[model samples]
Target: MKILFLGQLIGKQSIAFVKEHLASLKAEHQIDCTIAVADAVTGGYGLGKNHAFYLRKLGIDLLLGGEAMLSKRDLVEELAQIHFVLRPANFTGIGNFGYGMRHLHTPKNQQLNIINVMGMMGFHRVHASNPYQLVNKILDNPKHPSPFTLVAFSAIASAEKQTMAHMMAGKCSAIIGYGAKAITLDAQIIDETAYITDVGRISAPFSVAGFTPESEIERYTTQRPRKSEELISDEIELQAVVITLDDETGKATHLQPLRATYPLNVKAPANTSAESTTP
Candidate 1:
């Protein structure tokens, strides 16, 4: 079985750009299931329930979001009952938002469990518990009848992701990863035991990680440039990762990194401007 995961979608163009490719890839690749990051779907802020529903209808199996998705009031209310989406499971608070994980009831006759967790060190406002602890609780639950298929996250760093994958080892099939910023196709295979991969963004193919470069250049142009909230890219490509699972073992054995670029032009500032708008 093949699972397709998309990076963060920042705006309407990004959404449309993703959908256009998703339809083609679904048929061409025989994609069994698909998931997309949700925080920036509605004008780069929190996702609206309506937007979530639209994405579901467009063939994405799950809509995954980060801390920003919880910022809206009405959206949070709807997300609590929305079965096709998930938020970080590690959050701790009185009125926290949606589920941190979900099980896929595939009509194609396959059962897959997917989880979402957040790292403790990020800019999020909620008090987040240790994700490793939460994973232990869920995996150890007697009432839970399914195997832990995969875990996804939207966070500040990759260090935690690699650590979690190494810790989980043979307990889960694969760990899905993508940071809030940084657009690179990176996957780490731990002792041939598990897979951890990050899918960055689907924004302007020429812009920096899909955001306008004015802010990024101004902030980091002086002393030393560092990759922060801006994904590590000046060109846009709708990036995603495809993992093929072992039919019986359900362990992910093959990892495929995918990217598609458009003809869009992103202008650079006068100081850093490039003469070419070509892809």
Candidate 2:
């Protein structure tokens, strides 16, 4: 099956690593996958003409652009298929936007699932205030038509992560944490969806830095000095949202993450079980 790995762009520095990863996957596993970088060729942290050109050369089937980057006639017509990753359901940065997919390989195929990721270093909200509204807007937009499975990613403190996890557990498709990074949750599926699998999860590199218990307490004391006078706890929250469009049920289900990390055995819950049963 073909898969698209959507990753963040740090700058030209990622070019080499990006190319190497894709090439190796194609050559070794015969996997048909594309890497969509959130930012690379443009100054606004979105895809630009040059960026698209470079990525295409590197074997990217589709290079995504940000929603806010006005229209470029040449790009609109040329990269139309893969252009404009949908704006996040709720989050919107000045130069940043979101992308949604109707189908993994084809557009307007609501049958397709999409995963949206936003990384937080400290405290800058990435997407929209009302993410659910933003999500609905995307689904209902007439100009850009498509059905989709939506998922979102963000980092958070472990404690807040647990609270969100417990509160949003079963309600989310799969809530996962990146350990002191961000929290991610699905825009849909509310209530009783909690699962024990989301806590203390880590990603591939195993290098994503996590905050120490002590450091967090110190951070709060420094930021909100008076809050220290009250009871304080240490925990980071990281989360991801998973949206699934079930063909059989003809309904889109949303699931929120309880923690930043997902269980090792299950990177993705919805697709994992199906992939196993496919063969």
Candidate 3:
């Protein structure tokens, strides 16, 4: 009953969601290993200070990019069991004490392995970094254990992952796509690998963005020449636009326009003609 969890980081919320879901997945599927591939945590949908601290508190091991993970090795080691794998992950450093974790998800000889790769468009800046290369490198290297399952949290569109699906179709036992990209990628993987997509690794409430709302009401008082009067109010809509880049592509792929309406509540500047009078 061993399993792997795969995914891409969209933001702090993404990590929050994964950490929340991991416990349930472990209990339900009996997962034994997890390998998450990501760009810089701070740069993309990374773990912020608070979120990072919280994740450590939850006992989830995290692998940060070379710069972030290697520089703060001392602090990272003391805080939690998380490891920050330097760029270009090879099997040699797979069990490094400072940058990697070993003997985790124990009961050695487990069959499951999870690999989460960040796919947000343009969210990463590493040179010559490609999923195909990374996966191929891992396969070519003799350092990693074999006869284990591999799952990828690929965020590429369904069409893009197809090529990889073909290559790894039979090599790996199974592949599962996660996050919003799964909607289409899952179907493609089925067609290629003859294996249906696994929905277990993904978190619910899977929309890519998060937001909050605020409302304001302005009240006014006015008199119309001592005549009987009535009050009126009008609502106006205000829109806010937030542009965000896709995590993997690092391009402005998402444009979120938030629309909100607020009532100005004007009283005719206190000088409106009397519509009704009984003086």
Candidate 4:
């Protein structure tokens, strides 16, 4: 089975771009299933109910969420009800929210198990259980259902993510690291398991993590409260990774990173020169 795992979707525009190009991308890769991170799919902070439904309509089979999963309170009820959406499994009090693991039957009649877990280090604000322990408990289960398992390990530290990947190298089919919004160059197969440090984001290429550079710079320099981040409307691209699993063994056979530029109809805004003061 071939699975196309896209990077985080930043905002409404990013959603639109995906909707426009997703079918072509699937056809280009002969993809059988599609999955994407839903941390910032609404207005760049959290996934809203409407946006989640729209993403599903666009042919995304599953949605994964990270630390900012519940940033939008409106999505709480929807998450519980939806079977295609998932939050971090190790999150504290996770039973109240949605699930973090799901077993799905793909179009090719293959069972795929997916788990979303958040690291403990660096994410001080998030209260979550130890991801390592949780992952072990699930993978080591006596009656673990699916042989094809994918782990979405979201973390801020590269070392932590790498550690998780190595630990699960021979256990799962793939481990995709995210939450940093930048694609890492270390995409490889380890012990038949596909691993990528970071999957990148599906947003503008000319901005800072898909946001306007000016706004991010100002906020960092000022060290004060600033307005919401503004999404850059130019040079959008879809960055993701595709993993192919053996039909019988459920081990990853191939790992490929994909990047495609979106053709925007509107032209980029021209730079304006500052006027000189009267002499």
TM-score of each: 0.82, 0.41, 0.46, 0.92
Candidate 3 residues lying further than 4 Å off, grouped into runs, are: 4-25, 34-44, 59-105, 111-126, 149-155, 178-208, 212-279
TM-score winner, 2 or 4 = 4
* Candidate 2 lDDT for residue 182: 25
Worst 10 residues of 3 by lDDT: 211-220
Number of backbone collisions per candidate:
3, 60, 15, 0
- Top candidate (TM-score): 4
Q: What is the C-alpha lDDT of each candidate?
A: 0.67, 0.35, 0.35, 0.82
Task: For model 1, give the 10-residue run with minimal summed lDDT.
Answer: 270-279
- In model 4, the number of clashes is 0
Q: In candidate 4, how many Å is residue 204 off?
A: 0.8
Which candidate order results from sorting by lDDT in descending order? Answer: 4, 1, 3, 2
lDDT at 247, model 2: 36
Candidate 1 vs candidate 4, lDDT winner = 4
| Comparison by TM-score, 1 against 4, better one | 4
lDDT comparing candidate 1 with the true structure: 0.67
Question: How far is each candidate from the true structure, as Cα RMSD in Å?
Answer: 7.1, 13.2, 18.4, 6.7
How displaced is residue 106 in candidate 2, in Å? 6.2
lDDT of 3 by residue, 1-279 (tens): 233333333233334444545466445444444334332233232233444454445444443332223223333344334433322232233243342222233355332333433333333332224566666665566354544434353343444345556766655544544333223223322322323232212211322121111101111133333322222224322222222222232222322332333333322122111122211
